[model samples]
Structures are given as C-alpha cells and as structure tokens.
Target: MSRTKSERYFFLDDADREAVQAKGRAHNRLGLVVHLTSLRYPGRFIPDPRQVPTEIVAYLAE
Candidate 1:
C-alpha cells in the first residue's frame, strides 16, 4: 500500500485490498481507512462490469 493520506471518502473492495494498492499506484493517494459498517441500499453498491475507472479497469482487463 502507498503511504499517502487524505480526507476524501471513497469505497473499495473489502476482500481484495489489492485494489487499494492498485488505486495507490494509479494516483498515489491514501487516507484514513474507515471501514463501512453497512450499506443503505445494496443494489446501489453493485459495480457496473461495463464501466470502470480507466486506470484500474485496464489492469482488470489484463
């Protein structure tokens, strides 16, 4: 994991934290690791397989 920090709130995979490392590699950014306790609507949380962030998505495609 990259040693960067910030105050922005974002979500990531709980199981594969490698995504976090990947995110860091993409932008070299990081912050307080606040774990989400619950999801208000699980449906809204589902990721769209067709659309993904450009940087990390490229890695997934490979």
Candidate 2:
C-alpha cells in the first residue's frame, strides 16, 4: 500500500494578524487604482505616478 503525504497549514498569531489588518486598511485608503496595482504586482507598491505612462493612468482613471 502507498502512503499519502500530509499537508501542513500555517497561521498568524493575534498580534501579527492585527498588524496585517492595519496595514491592509491603510493601503485601501490610498484609492482604487493603487489597491488594484498592488494586487496585480505584489512586489511593487506606491509606484510614482509621474513615471507611469499617461495612457495607463487614463485607462485606470476610467
């Protein structure tokens, strides 16, 4: 008979969970465009608006 591998799960402690929640709330207040981009590119946050292409910004505006 073959043995099945067990799965592991990890969880955040109360303090860590609270800290993450607070950070998420602050990020949400930055506006929809910011929130969307952050979700799309997890590594990048608050990229400079001036450096972004005008066409992209216009698209996001709509």
Candidate 3:
C-alpha cells in the first residue's frame, strides 16, 4: 500500500495571532505572514504577493 501525504497545519496561537493581526491592513498582514511562514517552512521570503503560492496566501489571509 502506498503511504499518503501528511497534513500541514498552520495554527497561530493567541498572542502570536494577535501580534500578526496588529501588523495593520491587509497589505501589511500578508507581508508579515509571508515573512513568518517562509521561516517556518523550507522556503525563502517571497518579494511579491502575486508570486506566493495560492494555498499559502489563502491560509495567511484567514
């Protein structure tokens, strides 16, 4: 039997979540999320939001 891929969970805790929310505006929020997720994952910081993955951008947008 083939093994399935693992699920990735991007859960931001209360204090951290508030800090992220405090960044101000959708533009700034997206930027900070990109910076944070880049370090959490195996990728580098994306310079453009248009270039960031749809999955990542959607998750952060929530």
Error of 2 at 6 (Å): 41
TM-scores of the models, in the given order? 0.20, 0.34, 0.64
| Residue-level error in angstroms, candidate 2, position 49 | 1.7
For all candidates in order, the CA lDDT equals 0.31, 0.41, 0.63
lDDT by residue (tens digit), candidate 2, 1-62:
11111001112346634545555454342344544454454445546646544544443443
Which parts of model 1 have CA positions greater than 4 angstroms off?
1-44, 47-51
Per-residue lDDT for 2 in model 2?
12
Over the stretch 1-62, how does candidate 1's per-residue lDDT look in tens digits? 11121111233455435644545443332321121211221223334433333433333222
**Ten residues in sequence with the least summed lDDT for candidate 3:** 1-10
Q: Which structure is stronger by TM-score: 1 or 2?
A: 2
Looking at model 3, residue 48 earns an lDDT score of 66
Quote the lDDT for 37 in model 3: 68
Tens digits of per-residue lDDT for model 3, 1-62: 11111114344567767888888888887778677766665566656657766666666677
The list of candidate 2 runs beyond 4 A from truth reads 1-31, 38-43
Best by TM-score: 3
- The stretch of ten residues in a row with the least summed lDDT in candidate 2 is 1-10
RMSD of each: 11.0, 13.4, 4.9
